[model samples]
Target: MNTWQQAALAAEIENQAQVPVLSLAASASVRPSRRLGRPTLIQMGSNIYEQVRCISAIVRSYHWRGVIAIYEDDAYGGNAEMLTLFSEALQRVGSEIEYHLSLPPISSLSDPRESVYQELLKLLSTQSRVFIVLQSSLPMATHLFQEARRMDFMGKDSAWIITDSISSFLDSMDTSVIPYMEGALGIKSYYSKSNRPFLEFSAQFQKNFKSENPEENNTQPGIHALRADDSIAVIARALERLASDDTNTPKMMLKNILARNFSGLSGNIIFEGGDLSNSNSLLFRIINVVRTGYKELDFWTQDLDNPFRREGRDKNSSRNTTKVLDGPVIWPGYLIKRVPKGWEMPTDAKPLKIGIPAKTSFDKFVKVDEAEAEADKRYSGFCIDIFREVLKILEQNYSLPYEFHPVIGTYDELVDFVYNKVITPISSL
Candidate 1:
């Protein structure tokens, strides 16, 4: 059949598929934890006008004038719209904007050290004013900060403004400077839905899958447990429309979703101007390092009346632009800081043996030789690859002499190993 006919048949087949609906979804089976988790999820995005306002406020407040935004030189980074808004805003109060440069994403940089650093030095020499970084990757931010610190680029003259791309722990403490990255500010997002529309979504989600949950446990799955919820949410709406309408049109469903508002567990998502790619976004602010972490100062939401960030206004002067929180806009820096109290690497660079759960959803997904199920690959499979990345990062960045050596151990074997050796000293430490 033709392409349209093929899509039509697939849509029909999806409806006929025996997959359980979200309303009658089955409970997720739990497996034993084989290794300790050092989890930090980082999602990246582009700069919107709201981000511009919030970050600009913090930067200009520090008495520094002018800006030099070194972004990833791609459609995602060197956005002309965002650059114009930021540059214009910076110039509003007579602040001099020295430069706005877009570098390649770290993923594409074949020669990150020489090429990235050389271009950075060029910006440093030519456009050394106020630094505004817009890298979409955390590793790239770390590299830049590390290089800048090694080059002794911190002082009264050189100021920086970054985003949530860098950790707050690194921001305030200035482990590179060992004292602080004082005066440097940025924007970060860290609000649970429960804090706002959180309870509403939780209540509905619990209702939707309440029957599937084991009655005895009497508890909803954790936030982590809801990781699969996104994929389900996207597919669920499609299935529901297909089931209810019997038309099973993707374009129509897409139209319906865009016409209305969607309040997800993350936040309210709205599609505007037919850009299904989710272009316009909310903005947040990082005030200053409070203690050993970066704190969120404010937010500039798309909604004018949102009290989350600051008082924003529409032409009508109807909604309250600023959201007034329970307390002053303050974010505890440790919120995003690395917490490795008992997990710190020692001087000897000991390879802290980690017992892998020999056959986990994570591990089973990585056995390349075996023919894998689509669901297994789609859901549980990325764990091993993720674990490898973590190990690689630890080996590359931390005090470890060698890589984080991974050893295979079963559930019972891991339990015994932890009980006899690993658990004892760590508990005391």
Candidate 2:
């Protein structure tokens, strides 16, 4: 199926018609039926469980209580379901989504980049700076991020976490879009490239694939391709175990497949509960994008406690398991230190009112020129000048709004007013 939702719906329809189906697609296992002999799913895509664990670990490490979620619209079939899984993962770690936004499919929108910018602006209007993006393809991710950079949303205070569906194909992404993706953190499927079996399969597959499709030149086989080959092997092996004369029913074939085990190009091919067995082979790698491309910052497996260890180091030592990265990450704005706090005050908060002493003995230092005949009034003093300078400095970091309010009382009265009230009081003695 072309879309995740369509694939799932097709499976359900085939099941109702009593036709057994074995699905080899990315989003088929997004929400699988637990009932036996319904549809056997051979996942050739990213698993939602591992994604949940990896992203939750990063969010917890940063101590972010809330974030905004942006995803492709459900017209793509499985986007909504993926978002549900994301929300559940955040809730499990005592964190939550502050807001969730949906972007229309690229084909449906006249200008997808403009759509992304509008949605991104809505995200910026909120207090949350941390964003979790769920997309099905690399190009769509590039489109969204390019717009984010244009809006100045990709800054030192911003944090972006992307799922495997988008990140797995980073090596093949267009170079023009790579600059906009710098400082982004992504989760991707992992396999040991150094393994002899994997290397042998990769070489042969690349050679054979090029020979068969000469016109489709300069192509490289990705994880999905390897999984496709393995999926066929699994079905073929299951067919071999079936009796030559026995009926090839869907249920019978599923039983035979589940009972068998084999090794494939990427890793061991096994299934549990209609999905791939998530053991050592169901691994994930977290990467940070830089000017050059991306670098592996952390590795995670089902059995590892210390997921973030220095590269080339095999075992854990004394580092805290909860710390997400092995070393410092280069954030947006080329910052190499200081983790972002993930949220800021919205632009709608009330302005600060600074109470100033109007009736003061020192007119040069503090003076409030009040128009007795009219409602207009003005204030000027050395203290007022200093306050304005400090506010200017704060403008660089914060969107603070403040104004000096002339107090019609003595310094002691102003002090008493500030003591009883919440407004900040200033004086020039």
Candidate 3:
């Protein structure tokens, strides 16, 4: 039932039966052609595009230039659209997806642990340490992170950012799996807990939930549960409005439901184009996973134009101009305060070899003095000085390991050496 195919089939069956479908979990963007000029399915959940915008803002805030995308592979084209959305979102923030690692649904694999371990091994070969997980279920995400931690992928230089798919259900996950995913960041739909209706509902829900499922430890309802309550509220309101009219056709009910707008448990319940509109009231909470659970770092709202502003912060304050998170984050592994660079060099990577001409007419531009001891050879010139200074500046921010090698060849030979991969690109005077 997690796949789009199953959801589509369910929707089709409901449409044929002339029943209105209110989905609380599915957020796939259905094509207009499939709707046939009228929509049968009304998604009460938050929009995926809005989630993408929040994630883009986080990437910008961290200054990560590239990230690897890890997502569940779906055969029914649902994940394809997700990848396209993520790619476009990252591009808008001056970042791009460096690699896409598709994991099969955990149910499809015979040995999920081995499968995840093999996948993590493939990622170790790449330089991108920043990972964005999309469309992953709780079980799959837990196993993936467990394998990642086992393989040392959750080190200080690494970062993991998860979308709402897994974040929404973090409360229900087993506490044993949390250690593997500590220091990860996630975004989930926000709701007002202080509201009277929600507070009363939460109290009643806990009592009923514990009574029905005694073995379950966490009785707190998640975002989907809140949305389900709101969905029912929406239908009840629509039915009340239609009580005056004798004719309550499916189309009429749909119209009435779409026309009604009010504040509900999951924020402003407003529908446009058969889905929840991206309104200012709809907010996403940014969370950082700690040893004891996750902490709310900040909130992202459309009203602020995608910045991660703190709750109750002044709207007109000039100090909040930058799109930065308000609190410090416990980054991956041992680095609690230091931010990850989002990438790292491979352990076996060789130092960059810069080839310089052995003989030059203008010693001022390029000169190489060969000593009796080959190891004592001296290299000096305006270009070498400039290169040394540039390396010094770069080393201040990056660990750029490089060495100079004098090549006994003409200018043409040096160019050929670069073209043939024999030497790295050389800067000319």
Q: Where is model 3 more than 4 Å wrong at Cα?
A: 1-5, 16-18, 26-38, 212-217, 241-243, 303-306, 316-323, 350-429
Model 1's C-alpha root-mean-square deviation from the true structure amounts to 25.6
Identify the candidate with maximal TM-score. Answer: 3
Q: Candidate 1's residue-wise lDDT over 218-315, tens digit each?
A: 33333322323543555566556667885566455644444444555434444333221223344343455433444455544454333244334342
- List where candidate 2 sits over 4 angstroms from the true fold: 16-31, 35-37, 40-42, 76-81, 205-220, 242-245, 303-321, 344-429
TM-score of 1: 0.47
Residue-wise lDDT of candidate 3 within 21-43, one digit each (tens)? 77665565633213433367777
List TM-scores for all candidates, in order: 0.47, 0.73, 0.82
Tens digit of per-residue lDDT, candidate 2, span 1-429: 545455556666777554435554455344364542446444445566567667877887788888888877758456656667778878877788888888877778788777777777777556678888865456567888888888877777788888776776665455556778888888877776777877787788768877876665334556666677777787788788776737767777777777667767656767777666665633777788887778888776654344444547655442344565865787766767788778764344545556777788888887787765442236677877777789789889888765557777677878777545545444432
Order of models, best lDDT first: 3, 2, 1
Q: Candidate 2, after superposition: displacement of residue 121 in Å? A: 2.2
Cα shift from native, residue 121, model 1 (Å):
2.1
Can you rank all candidates by TM-score, best first? 3, 2, 1
Candidate 1 C-alpha error for residue 403, in Å: 55
- Give stretches of model 1 more than 4 Å off: 1-47, 75-78, 124-128, 164-183, 193-235, 275-283, 287-292, 300-429
Clashes of 2: 1
Worst 10 residues of 1 by lDDT: 27-36
